[model samples]
Target: MADLSSNAPANQFRIAVKKQKVWLASALILLVTALLAPDQATESLGFVAKSLTQTGPYLLLSIGIAAWAVATGADNLIARAFTGSPALMIFLAALAGGLSPFCSCGVIPLIAALLTMGVPLSAVMAFWLASPVMDPSMFFLTSGVLGFEFAIAKTLAAIGLGMAGGFIVLALAGTHVLHDALRDGVGNGGCGAAKIRSPKPVVWRFWEQSERVEKFGKEAVKTTLFLAQWLTLAFLLESLMLAYVPAETITSILGGTGIGPIAIATVVGVPAYLNGYAALPLISGLMEQGMASGAGLAFLVAGGVTSLPAAIAVWALVKPRVFALYIGISLGGAFLIGLAYQGWTLL
Candidate 1:
């Protein structure tokens, strides 16, 4: 009736806007601040600019590493971790989960494939627990936003949580507790299945191939834009948070070390968590407001593993009982890791 074909351009524009929601949101925040709080708007802009410039080198390094992984196909090595004995596989999987380049969502297809392939749940659980928490790009970004020590501690936490989850699942594997781990019809196929099922050999000298050079450039640009947009939004929000949120509020809730604050942080981390990259600047702002290091650690670890996106992906792939165990391991292991880091800081 109303010339539907004529509205194609409008529909396309709406789709484009939806795809760039983060960027649009960032722009909207700035526009509102400019109109409502003109003076603070300038400061916010300066803060975001300065912060981005400061982290520029680390950002570049992270982008390069990610691009290199793509070009050389080093990520394929992640599949190799499942080939050994249960104990050995768990060890390797945990380490790979810490070091591999896959994000939580990106690792989903691989996880599905591994489960379908009859890989033991122990090692799969280990990788699943750790993969969401840390990786090469994440390490450099955390180091830039937080500190080297903090980043290193987080990496260790990732590996440790994976190991703990793996072994616990290992012990329970024989108990029928983990029976029917995956949901029916869940692991048929998905986006990254081919990479896991038919991995290509790594070409360490990827520069020699014209296609690899093109891939490296494309990946570098894609990763750079992704990190830049998220960091921009994060820093902008952080500046506003620092300006508005009172110091005593954060301190009272998440400060002054001990198991109490750490546990609270872990619980809060789940719902309060934003994108991992965005959360870094906000957490830095919170810590500046007197949030304890242990609380910060717990918040990050828990959020990485149990954030809504990660949790939903897991739920879609696994049965309810297995999902419960996953959550249990994530929270429990995050708490222990937080305690360990807190003790380390004290000493």
Candidate 2:
């Protein structure tokens, strides 16, 4: 009779090999399909390339922060900082989230790092929801393109919504709802359930360890590949959206102050909002065409918060429940903000 223990390792290896072959075969089929649809493939590839180009600076920022955190043992420092006060930490996390310039996908590595180091998911969610909406550049661009009122309102909403998300998540903490996102820190006070752990070495200086750079390099490569695959899928789906969704379909409402128009704007914006920069011009055009200020505000907010790329990035990191909560925060925030703007305008 064969010894079960002796074959366990070999059986596991075989299973892993089989999974890889399945993936390889799937990739080949996709390659063949792409070759058959050359134009569609080119368009999709172009968008992916463009997305990578746009994401480079943010990716560098994420990688830099991750590396520094590992080298200086900053994850532990952050964990300790989180221990100070839950209320304040939520506010600060949301505030930091607003200040980031990275797109949603670009922030994934950093989010992963924070979570891996046992940072609380609620704080991470706050940062996650706020970061994509407006950074300094986005702020300036919005002010220039959409006017000070629109820009200021969005800035306020980002922070408020971020804090709102944090509080809601914190309130729901220690429940079955947060089980997946709370992850390692489940019952602990924001990533303190277990010891702080950085993905790579936790040396004082990067150069102190001979293998630190190599480890970081490998991690960077892995991150880049993981992001590339996900971003490519997002780009492809967005391209289909752009190809099919009619421009007039969005402008039909004339940006009215009513509930219907506002709701329409939010719905359209979820699928329609592309890069913030690109959306500015389109929104401007829509506004000029009698789009209501409230509708525009809702559209911009919803678009930025749940942009396809950002949502995809989010889904890649967190559980389904967390993703749903994030969407709820974005949508609810958009609705309230739009309502306020309309009321101010007496719409």
Candidate 3:
């Protein structure tokens, strides 16, 4: 018994190192492949650089949020975001999701960190659903290409879907159907769970303490490293798609206007939906090719929530059940929203 207990930690450490090596190996392989294609690699590298630049500020913001929440044990403070109404909290978070500049991939670090800090799964799920669907810039761009009414409808759908995801998780909280929505390993596999010290007042002054600084530093590095590795892997995969997958292939299939088309859109959106800004023109072009309004909306919503980049980001930090719930809500919501938009169009 004593020998087993002593070896348990060493076993865990070995597993962790193995995981890190896999990520490192994959990243290194991708780097080598990208280097081999000098002309295409230039574009891929450019995309990576641009992505990192944009994601940096958001990553830093996540670090600050994570640091504070961890150091001061402020999950309660976040818990107090509303008056005991999970629905209202979900609504507010959904609104913030629409407002933030992040694409879904960019927001994962924050979501991962937030969940790690013990923020309830419902609100984070709410933000997760809405953030990628419609940001402020995406809203305006969608309006410019798809028109004002379409833009407004898409925005409403984004928020409504967010609310739906949050409430769905809330409803299932005590039920076995979605048990452990915030699963174990959420705080980096429970590594720092016990080490965290809740300062009396959850404030900035606590940051001055050497112990607090040390804790914050460890948390920051752990989070950043985890996020950066997954993100780089996601970006490398995206670069491959961008280099090879033709845009016309997407628009061609989306021309059909029925349930089948919408279903196809949902599936395809995962790999094809780049980002809202890039999608506006593609969706607009699809419309010209007889893409149904509802199908188009479905594609955008589905793509936003479950795109490869974003899904990979979420999967890296969450358990299988939580990830499945996030996806279930995304697909289900996208289908409903698409159908609703179609009905409105016919009216």
In order of listing, the candidates' clash counts read: 0, 2, 0
lDDT digits (tens) for residues 1-347 of candidate 2: 88899999999999987746534543564476487876766675676577557655654555555444444543443333244467887787777767644557666666666676566777877777787787655665566556778888878778787888889989999998888673333222233323334333347777667677776677566545544444444445445445445656655664556788888888888987756656764676567566788888888889998988778867776778878888988898887777788888783
Candidates sorted on lDDT, descending:
1, 3, 2
Q: What TM-score fits each model?
A: 0.96, 0.59, 0.58
In model 2, where do residues sit more than 4 Å from their true spots?
1-83, 182-252
In model 1, what is the error at residue 337, expressed in angstroms?
Answer: 1.3
Candidate 1 lDDT, 167-267, residue by residue in tens: 99999986667877778897545656666678889999999999999999999999988998899999999999999999999899888877888999899
| lDDT score at residue 312, model 3, on the 0-100 scale | 81
Which candidate comes out best when scored by lDDT? 1
Off by over 4 Å in 3: 1-83, 182-184, 188-257
TM-score of 1: 0.96
Q: Please report the candidate that would top TM-score against the real structure.
A: 1
Tally clashes: model 1: 0
- Across 222-267, the per-residue lDDT of candidate 3 in tens digits comes to 6677556655555555566656756566556665456777777777
Error of model 3, residue 99, in angstroms: 2.5
